[model samples]
Target: MLVTFLIITVTFAILTMLPLSRHEAWWIRGLDFPRLQLFLALLFTLALELSLLDLSSKQTWGLVAVALACLVYQAWWIVPYTRIFPREVKAANNSDSRGRIRIITANVLMTNRNAKVLFALIREFQPDILVTLESDLWWQSQLDILETDYPYTIKCPLDNLYGMHVYSRFPMMNSQIEYLVEPDKPSMHALVLLPSGHKVRVHFLHPAPPSPTENNESSERDAELVIIAKSVAETNVPVIVTGDLNDVAWSETTRLFRKISGLLDPRVGRGMFNTFHADYWFLRWPLDHLFHSKHFMLQSIKRLRSFGSDHYALFTELVLTADTNNEHNGLDADADDLAWAKRKTEDQNVDKSAVPQPEKHSVA
Candidate 1:
C-alpha cells in the first residue's frame, strides 16, 4: 500500500508541473486538459494517506506534503471558474432586447449524423447567432433549413473535422474565412450588425489539437491563437471570439490569449460549463467557449444538452451595455506574455497581408 501511494503521488505531482514548461509537445500540452481530474485524484490520495498515517516514517509525511501541494496547484488554476471567485464579466442590469445577443456554439462531431437533435435545440432557443464546428457537407446541407430564419451566413464545409459554419440573423459585414495555421483548417471572421445598429466583430475558430492523430505539437494552435489575439488587441470595435478552441479555459495558452486580447470570460466566476466528451462524465472539460469584450454583460450562460456529438452545445446571452464601471478590469499582458506572443507569431511568420479579404454572401 505504501509503494502504491508513493507512485500515485509522485506521478500526479509530475503531471501537475509538466505544463509549466513552454514545450508544445502533445504529451505536455495534453496534461492541461485534465486539471480537474488531477485535483480529484490528488484529493482522494491525500485522504487515503491520512487515514493510514504513520508519523514514524518520514517518507509518509513527505508523500503527504507533495500530494497536498499538487492538490493546491490544481485548485489555483481551476478555482476561478467556480462561483466562489468573483465574476470577470458583470451581469446584465437592464432588460433591453435590442442590445441582447444570444449565441450558441457546438462542435457537432463530423461523423455524428444526428443533425435533428441540434436543429431541435436551435428551434427551441432561437439564438441570434449559431456557430458549428466539425461540420461538413452533410451537416451544411442539413443546416440550410436555417436560412429561412438566419438570412446571413458564412460557410466552409469540408470533410476534414475542422470545418465550420456560422448562421446569423443579423447582417454580417466584411465576413471572411481565413486559414490561420494549417492550410486545411479554417476560421471565420465577421462584423455582425445588431438590431441596435451596433457592430460586433465576431470570430469563430476551430483550431487543431496537439495529439498523436492530429498535429504532433501545439505550435500551430498556439501560433494561430496569438495571431488572432494580436488582431483583437488592435481592433477598436466590440469583439466576441467563440468556438471549440481544442484547449481548456484554464490552460497557459488560453490565459495568454485572454491577456493579449483583453477579452473577458463569462465562465470565470460562473462555472466551468464543461462541454466536451458528453458521454463520459469524468472525462469532460470546457472545450467549447465564448469570450467577449467588456462592453457586453452576461445575461445567462448554460451548457445545453448533448446532441449525439462528443461535445454539448454552449449557450450564452450577452447584452451590450455602456456601463463599464461595474465590469471587471480586463487582463493585461506583461513584458513576458507580450514577448512570448511575439515569438510565437514570428516563428509562424504570420503575415497580415496574407489573410484573405471578406467574401460577401447573404442568403436573402
Candidate 2:
C-alpha cells in the first residue's frame, strides 16, 4: 500500500509541473487541458494519505506535502473560472433590442452525419450570427436552408476538417476568407453592420490542435492567434472573436490571446461550460469560445445540447453600450506580452504564395 501511494504521488507531481515548461510539443502542450482532473486526483490522494496517518514516518509526511503543493497549484489556475472569482465582463442591465447581437458557434465533427439535430438548435435559438467549424461541402448543402433568413454569408467548404462557414442576419462589410498559418486552414474576417447602425469586427477561427495525429507542435496555432491579436489591438471598433479555438479556456495560449487582444471572457466567473467530448461526461473541457471587446456587456451565455458531434454549441447574447469605461474590464498586455506576441508572429515560416488574396462576397 505504501509503495503504491508513493508511485501515484510522484506521478501526479510530475504531471502537474509538465505544463509549466515553455515547450510547444504536443505531449507537453496537451497536458494543459486536464488541470481540473489533476486537482481532483491530488485532493483525493491527499485525503486518503491523511486518513492513514503515519506521524512517525517522515516519508509519509513528505508525500503529503508534495500532494498538497500540487493541489494548490492546480487550484490557482482553475479557481478563476468558478463563481468564487469576480466576473471579467459585466452583465447588461437594460433590454435594448437594437444594440443586442446573438451568436452561436459549433464544431460539428466532420464525420458526424446528423444535420437535423443542429438545424433544430438553430431554429430554437435563432441567433443573429452562426459560425460552424469542421463543415464540408455536404454540410454546406444542408445549411443552405438558412440562406433565406441569413442573407449575408461566407463559406469556405473543404474536405479537410478545418473548413468553416459564417452566416449572418446583418450586412457583413469587407467579408473575406484568408489563410493565416496553414495554407489549407482558412479563417474568416468581416465587419458586421448591426441593426443599430453599429459595426462590429468578427473573426472566426478553427486552428489545428496539437495532438499525436495532428500537428506535432503548437507553434502554428500560437502564431495564428498572435497574428489576429496584433490586428485586433490596432482596431478601436467593437470586436467579437468566436469559433472552436481548439484550446481550453484556461490554457496559456488562450490567456495570452485575451491579454494581447484585450477581449473579455464571459465564462471567467460563471462556470467551466465544458463543450468538447460531449459523449463522455468525464472527459470534457471547453474548446469552443466567444470572446468580445469591452464595448459590449453580456446578456446571456449558455452551452447548447449536443448535435451528433464531439462538441456542444455555445450561445451568447451581448449588448453594445456607449460607455467607454467598460474598456477597463479587459486585461491589458504588458511589455513582456507584446514582446512575446511579436516573436511568435515573426518566428512562423508562412508561405506567402500559398495564401491567396481575400475574396469578397455578399448575398441580397
Candidate 3:
C-alpha cells in the first residue's frame, strides 16, 4: 500500500506541476483543468505516507518532501479562485444612472430537449441579456418568446452545436456573426447600446473544445481566443465577453486572454461556480465564463439551477461605472504576450478567409 501510494503521488505531482507553455497539445492543455483535483490527491497521498512510511528511511522522507511541495504549488494556482483570496473585480456601488445589466449565458447541450426548464429559469431571473450556446433551430424557436422582452437580438442557430444567440433588452449596434477559427462555428461581436446611451462591446463565443469529436488539439481554440483578445485590445472600449468558453476560468489560455483583452473576471476570490457536467457533482468544472472590461464593477454572479443540460445557466449582474476603470485588478499584457498571441492567431494552418471581419454586419 505504501509503495502504491508513493507511485501515485509521484505521478500525480509530476502531471500537476507540468508547465503549460504556448505549445498546442490537447493533453498538455487539458492538464490545466484539474488543479483542484490534483491538490486534493496530493493531500491524501501525503497523509497516507506520513502514517505508513518508515520514518528512518531517507527515501520516504524525500517522497514526503516532494508531495508537500507539489501540494503548495497547486494550491497557489487554485487558491485565488477560492473565497480564501481577495476578489479581482471590486464590488459596484448602486449605479442608478449608468444602469445595471443582468446577463445570463448557458449552453443548452444541443441534444438536451429541456427548453421548458430553461425558459422557466429565464422567466425567474428576467436577465437583460440572454446568450445561449450549443443551441439549434428548435432551441431558438423555443426561446422566440424572448423577442418580446429582449427587443434586440442576434441569432445563428446551428446543428453543429456551436450555434450562438444574444438577446438583449438594449439595442444592438452592428450585431454580426464571426467564424474565428472554424468556418461553421460562429461567434457574436456587437455593440450593445444601453439605456444610458453608452455602447458596450459584447463578444459571445463557443469555440470548439479539445475532444475526439472535435479537434484533437487545443490549437484552434487558442487561435480563436487570441484573435478576439487582440481585437478587444485595439478598441480600448468597455466590453463584455461571455459564453461557454469551453475552457476553465484558470487555464493559461484564459489568463493570456484576460491580459490581452484587459478584461476582469469576478470569479477570483469567489467560490467556484462550476457549471459544466450538471449530471455529475464530483466531476465538474467551470466551463462557462463572463469577462468584462475594467469599466464594469461586479454586482452579483449566480450559477442558476440545472435545466436538464450538461451546463448550468450563469446569471451575472454588473454595473457600468465611470471611475472604476483604474481601480480593478486586471492582467497587464506585455510585448512577449503580444508576440505569443500573434503566433497563435497567425499560425500556418489558420485560414484567414474563415476569420470574419468586424464590419460585415455594420449597417450604413
CA lDDT of every candidate? 0.90, 0.87, 0.82
lDDT of 1 by residue, 169-205 (tens): 9989888898987899999998888889888888899
Best by TM-score: 1
With candidate 1 superimposed using the best TM-score fit, by how many Å does residue 335's alpha carbon deviate from the native? Answer: 0.5
**After superposition, which runs of candidate 1 have C-alpha atoms over 4 Å from their true positions?**
326-328, 351-364
- Of candidate 2, the 10-residue stretch with the lowest lDDT total is 355-364
Ranking by TM-score: 1, 2, 3
The clash numbers for all candidates, in the given order, read 0, 0, 0
Q: Which portions of model 3 miss their true places by more than 4 Å? A: 19-22, 95-98, 325-328, 348-364
lDDT of 2 by residue, 135-187 (tens): 99999999888999998999999888998999999888878799889889899
TM-score, one value per model:
0.96, 0.94, 0.93
